[model samples]
Target: MSQEIQNISPIKQRILQFIAELGRSKREFYSLTGISRGTLESKTGITEDTLTKLFTAFPDLSPIWVFTGKGEKLQSQQNETSPLFTVNENIEDKLLNIIAQKDSEIKALAEEIGKLKQEIIQLKELLLK
Candidate 1:
């Protein structure tokens, strides 16, 4: 929001404080959100409106906890008692899908190679006849 932050809106101030409390930097937030500098600037400037927009855009974000500083850091309530943050479960699913596709491709290539080898052997025998 505001460069000095003194001129920042309430919502922007809370967001800034949340980032600080989370031990995260602006660059890290930028990478996660993929929002442009101009959009972020404009959004932060309109703190009240931006809070709703941001929460709507990032449902997984814990806006109340982030702003009020009273609850968990994460948006979604997690059941796991693990202290460390982990990668999203979807990542594992995506990796498994890719491995399966690659395995199928490998099997098809092996079959084609086997057919080519048989053809080469047959041609060699015909020529030697």
Candidate 2:
């Protein structure tokens, strides 16, 4: 029930801070960022894959800060600005859940697209016969 992460590395600590500042839930962070809760909690250091997932999920987050504790927390023309999207605290969990759901939907759609592409190729081959 607690969002508290144990055995967290500094980078992971910063990641938790970023997620907190975003007004998002740990489930949402895990779902959208593709970083498992276990990995974030247990890993002692950041990896290229972790950084990629983090940056991809939250482009506004400053890589420099995530990596070296330097620069603003956000990256923009004026870095002092707030998060791009604001969620009502009452509905924050719901909205994040929806985001996670959407991510799953997108992945499913991508797989469907790949299947469709294969079907199309087969159809073309049949037509050529």
Give the Cα-based TM-score of candidate 2 against the true structure. 0.52
TM-score of each: 0.36, 0.52
Scored by Cα lDDT, where does model 2 land? 0.80
Worst 10 residues of 2 by lDDT: 77-86
The local distance difference test score of each candidate is: 0.64, 0.80
Put down candidate 1 lDDT per residue, 2-66, tens digits, no spaces: 56566655556666665577687767765655544444434345545545655665677676665
- For residue 92, give model 1's deviation from the true position in Å: 41
Q: Candidate 2 on 1-129: residue-level lDDT in tens?
A: 244555667788888888888899888889988886766777477788888998998888888888788888888733546553456555777678779879999999999999999999999999999
The weakest ten consecutive residues by lDDT in model 1 span 35-44
Quickly count the clashes in candidate 1.
0
Off by over 4 Å in 2: 1-6, 77-129
